[model samples]
Target: MATLLGAGPGIVAAGARRTMTRCDGLASVSSSSHGIERVYLSAEHARVNRTVAGWMREIGMTTRVDAAGNLVGRLERATPSGAPDLDAPALVVGSHLDTVPDAGRYDGVVGVLMGLEAVRMLREPGPDGTGWRSPLPFALEVIAFADEEGTRFGRALLGSSAVAGAWDPGWWSLADDGGTTLHEAFVAFGLDPARVGEAARRPEELVGYLEAHIEQGPELDERGESLAVVSSIASARRFQIVVEGEARHAGGTPYDRRRDALLGASEAALAVERVCRAEHHVIGTVGRLETFPGAVNVVPGEARLSLDLRGELDDARDRVWRSIEREVDTIMGRRGLRWRSAEVHRAPAVFCAPLLQDVVREGIVSTLDRGVDDPATIFSRAGHDAMAIGAVTDVGMLFLRNPDGISHHPDEEVSAGDVARGTRALAEAVLQLAADRG
Candidate 1:
């Protein structure tokens, strides 16, 4: 058996370099008009999956495309005596392959590629001439989930949710920018929508889910840490808010006599920020706003806006929303404007399992054996596939430092060294889990 010392920094660094090369190659296959935009079931999606499948096959994994269009690569575990054990529950590792419009090269891509690298490190012989020192007790499955960005269908986590048996039938009616229904796109992509349920796995089928992603925030960079353990994923809710008033000529109508919907909406947006600021770890944003009859001389009789609220706790997020709603009511009442809001999306916070957290902590400590005994635990303000997978099994997350805390854009980046550290940490975590299970 190979010693842990054989998979040291040098070997890990080589693996990370390979991972970066693969990510760059995949980035070139995007379908973005401005930047990187590989959405669900698009031609780019198929191309990337083909490339990833090739990589998986090279590592001796059996690859398949799930009914929900997720790309899966399976490496069955073997007994200590080298006998294959096909019935073992899988230790799944992965992240979404889809991207937002004009996205950066890392984000979810790093997790998927790093996962493959970790498996490779485990399977290859170490420098000490020992082989398969830490054979996993469970099968290892790497998944490149299909639609976490929701760029094409406007519903995130479609791939992971399908795997968790949370597929919603109404999603078929969702339309894309090109007026194509999701159901039509599924058929066009050669995916049988009728068999989506086949993608769902029972709780007993999985040992757990683990993901390694770039820190989409500045916390890790500020702390000067290369990796950290995720404590929980934030809860989030979205709403479409509308304000209504009478229309008139902007120049002719007196300011005192006019009931402007745009003015009311502007005040409501500000109130959202103010209310969110009062609560700890809660955030609210008005990301989109538009005025009807957008002529220079016409008064904006109607205004539409979007609200996104998120918090570390479900009750806290709900409280902030209620406060914002009250503020909106006051703003509209004084302006003689009517207001209405429609909920668009909602997701509750998901906490990592304590056992999984310990394993991740050990992995981080083992990789970076500095005086750093305690790994930083950060709460994720962004949603992830782990949230959906949490429904079926325990979930854990490891975050690598993103230099500028920038993500979802072209400037997003991670250091090759940090990627190397993250890869080693994840591989160690898997080994630790195997030891615990045995």
Candidate 2:
């Protein structure tokens, strides 16, 4: 299909070495933030601060770090009199930059890079040495939030919660693998640990929030779609279950005499799968398992397993959990094992606002109208920074098609054409929302 665009492509010079290295620099910066394993609350995360700050400077935006260490980069609106609006909080756009162990480079980084691209496209002057008028009405604030993965700190959405006023001060005391508190990491990074509240912004200060992300699921590619306007995020719950039984020597104990924790754990795992099958909108996975005394000649005395539960509805999540809890009790009674289950994490489903949903729809439709290919209807299985922002202001999400339908892995891939389409769609969405903010 012929590409449809309102304006001829503006001549965008590649950002100098610093700007060009945005991706490499971001990766390098993240690598240093926690010494190449920058988990949340790690001293290495501090390393990312300088890199982000430097890029904000090169991008011509004034940079500041919030109490939670969320970096906000502001670019004021050029008013009719050429006075930049200082009071306006501006339209915010960005995503987290942290990663899982050797995670795919594109997952969260693409969104931030796209936001930078929008800013770059907006900042370049037209052929006449005058800036082209922007289609969007609000000033843009590009952001690169920290610590969404929780791989190290074991708490997801740490930075965004602070920005949204949802993070508890007590959260600072939470420890990592090295027993280091989040607050101590903050102090080491030159931030005041006591003033995390300062990171909270009143709702009025935000005009809107936009995020572009990869389709972390196979829905888009499976359906042969190029992009998806996210309608809502699924609710997710995580649990850790431990089954205890008496350890017995393999040769000494007869098969009937064994009180094996591994056997009980296996039954519990299959029970989880069965419960999910019985309930629609419910998906359960047991991703990890550790058995005590994992010797070939020994029956395991204790087994610990992780459970991940997801549903499209709140009640569905509750129902699934209840089923699992019941199964755990039944399994323990039959196997003569002591068992316990603990909730590790819970994130409620989030619905994107109708107004912003319209913007996303308009953006996609506009792009297709301009001869962009077909888009898709999809929801995010993974959580996003926008979910927090959605609680505060108008928020929208754009999902680019993943060619491999895989993410959070090293082999994740997206076509360049798909990315370009996503970029145009995002730019169009921002412009439409900005221009029509009456």
TM-score of each: 0.97, 0.90
What C-alpha lDDT does candidate 2 achieve relative to the native structure?
A: 0.75
Error of 2 at 344 (Å): 2.2
lDDT by residue (1-438, candidate 2, tens digit) is 222234334322332222335655555644433333456545556666667667667768898877887778888877678888788667888888778876766777777777776675566554645334453456788777888887867888888888887877667788777877887778876789878888877788988888888888888888777789988888999999999999889899987788899999999999999999999877899999999988988999999999999888879989989988898899889888999989988888888777777677776776565555446656777888887777778778899888768877767776655665666667667776765675
Candidate 1 lDDT over 100-161, as tens digits, reads 99999998999999999889888786575543445777999999999998989889999999
- How far residue 256's Cα lies from its native spot in candidate 2, in Å, is 1.0
Q: Tell me which residue pairs clash in candidate 1.
A: none
lDDT, residue 287, candidate 1: 93
- Show model 1 residue runs off by greater than 4 Å: 1-5, 126-132
Judged by lDDT, which candidate is best? 1
